[model samples]
Target: MLKGKLKLPDRLGNLVVDFEDRDDKIGGSSSVLASSEELEIILPNGLGFSRHKDDGDGLCCTEEKKTNEAAIFRASARPYKDRAGSVSAMAFIAADEKRSDFEYQSELKKNTEEELSSSKQNVDGDSDGLLRRHEISSEDHPLSLGKASVWNQYFQHMDIIEQIDRDLKRTHPEMEFFSGDTSFSRKNREAMKNILLLFAKLNPAIRYVQGMHEVLAPIYYVFCTDIDEKNVANAEADSFSCFVKLLSDSVDHFCQQLDNSSGGILSTLSRMSELLKANDEELWRHLELTSRVKAQYYAFRWITLFLTQEFNLQSVLRIWDSLLSNPFGIQEMLLRVCCAMLLCMRSKLLSGDFAANLKLLQNYPDVNIEQLLHVANDLSPDVSSYCPPL
Candidate 1:
């Protein structure tokens, strides 16, 4: 159901999950094992490294440069919204920009949250402990003497809310030839609603944070848009499974306790800094020392939210195409994209003061999406075409 190939760690050995970590079944054969390579991301074309004429600097991401100068895009700031999820980016690519799946998922999530929130009047402190109450006290409501059965109440309301939602979504069936008010629509809504509700229920530690809709939206969109009729029909279940997998990889960024651990957000930020340093030390130093810009100041959202906020939805999807297929895994690919973002704005960043640079970085500028992604693709750690960012 996934439109893009699942980005897997290289050690996964052509497998999305680690192949070597297989359980010791009495015996298992290679033929019987499923192959995930079909889903392995392949660059659509022209994004590949091109051989350029020789200049003194050998083998790099150069494009017909007479002096073999490092490639760089002239960055310019026009406008941007903080993009929040790679999953959302991927969701946009399954079809045209206008009718992306991410939109559908987020809309559904919003509708669900509002429905659930408005139903219970006592959503005051907004704590998991508070929400765990199956029944609110009569004194809290002051009007109803009967107790509330949260489960029964939610289900009863879920049907009504979902029906309303299906009616709304059904109005626009022209998009991707999607059916309106059909069994599939009801089923899809129920599945997506359950996934969102269940995720909130299971992860009581963090509860349901905002922007999760960004993550779940695209998965459902991508699945429902799948060319296969059967896959389109099962979009909800497929989306639920993919959302779990995608969220699992990123949930640590949301957990407060794990903030300083080796696997936490801080560690990821450090790695991103190191990635930038390896690719362009001067830029790294200027941002870190000259500008004294903290990684967390700008990179926290970039890393955690996955650049959904950094660029237009279309641009993010273009980058995510490579990210989801990077073979090295999403984390590594993401850092490269972030670094490319910096390099794209090299001149401004180099000349700007701390405040200016910070402001610019925080509100990343728009650039040629193709060039930006190409620069990022050239920044791979293991295989460098010496395509140093100018």
Candidate 2:
């Protein structure tokens, strides 16, 4: 008989497997590990094992005769990484044809739930650790139920709520999910509202703002339309997690107190001006002198709202794809995009005066998004140098 315990790393979370060998068969159960949605097992000597969902049962071997010969077993909670770099353990096993079928199903379900709980922990905590102290409550706001509370937390933030509601009613009017008061629309609105409320509650410093809905719309839409149907139901929860991740990087722009901080929008605008000067000094000089346009006049909206208000929905989404995908962070990509937008309308911008240039920038003209992104990417290779330190 053999008995031992296995330990996984911090990245893998706490996963322990305890095994015992008896009567030529080995049995063990794995403690829940992070991201354990699916478990993969490899039997020694190329013996195959298949699980049947129709009838809950113990794993079945491809060849009945080889079952008795199976002496070594390896199970992984996730895709196996390189063993050389990964921490691992070895255990020997013998397959038993008479193992309890119900026990296997019960264990599988328990493992799944543990993995889910672990995954939620990762999403909630995030990389910056801002979310660690905040606890999300399932209790519906009093406004949702129309029931008054002692503190009136919901009522205290009614203005923000009303703004969010009004924006939800007006946003993406053409899209079915955002258009009517239908079930889908309500679900999306509720998701957005809940996220904003929780965010404000968690970080009172940045609270809810008017244009935040626009910033959150695309993220919710993308998550809700996930290709995996299993994930669709949890779209709202997942979107909340992702929204927090996005905001963690750019939250300074939304906080007025941080205006002069290195991470703030004012600093971002200064960096944008530097980038423009480097990329197109003549165009930069023209905008500053002839148009009397300063970075803050237009960049306040562009930087804070992430250009969401400037471009059409389709174009905004495309630009966001580039912005989010950039390894250098959103601010650097944003400045480049701002520069590209200016350069794209160089002729019109240079020819226009103060009012005309301001109008053109505030009401950005519709341009080929692909071309715009291409131009943004084509800016100086050392764009990072111009970006303010985070």
- Winning model by TM-score: 2
Leading candidate by lDDT: 2
Clashes of each: 13, 0
lDDT values of the candidates? 0.63, 0.72
Tens-digit lDDT string for candidate 1 (229-255): 999888777887877777677788888
Work out how many backbone clashes candidate 1 has: 13
Residue ranges of candidate 2 with Cα displaced over 4 Å: 1-154, 381-390
Q: Give the Å shift of residue 5 in candidate 1.
A: 99
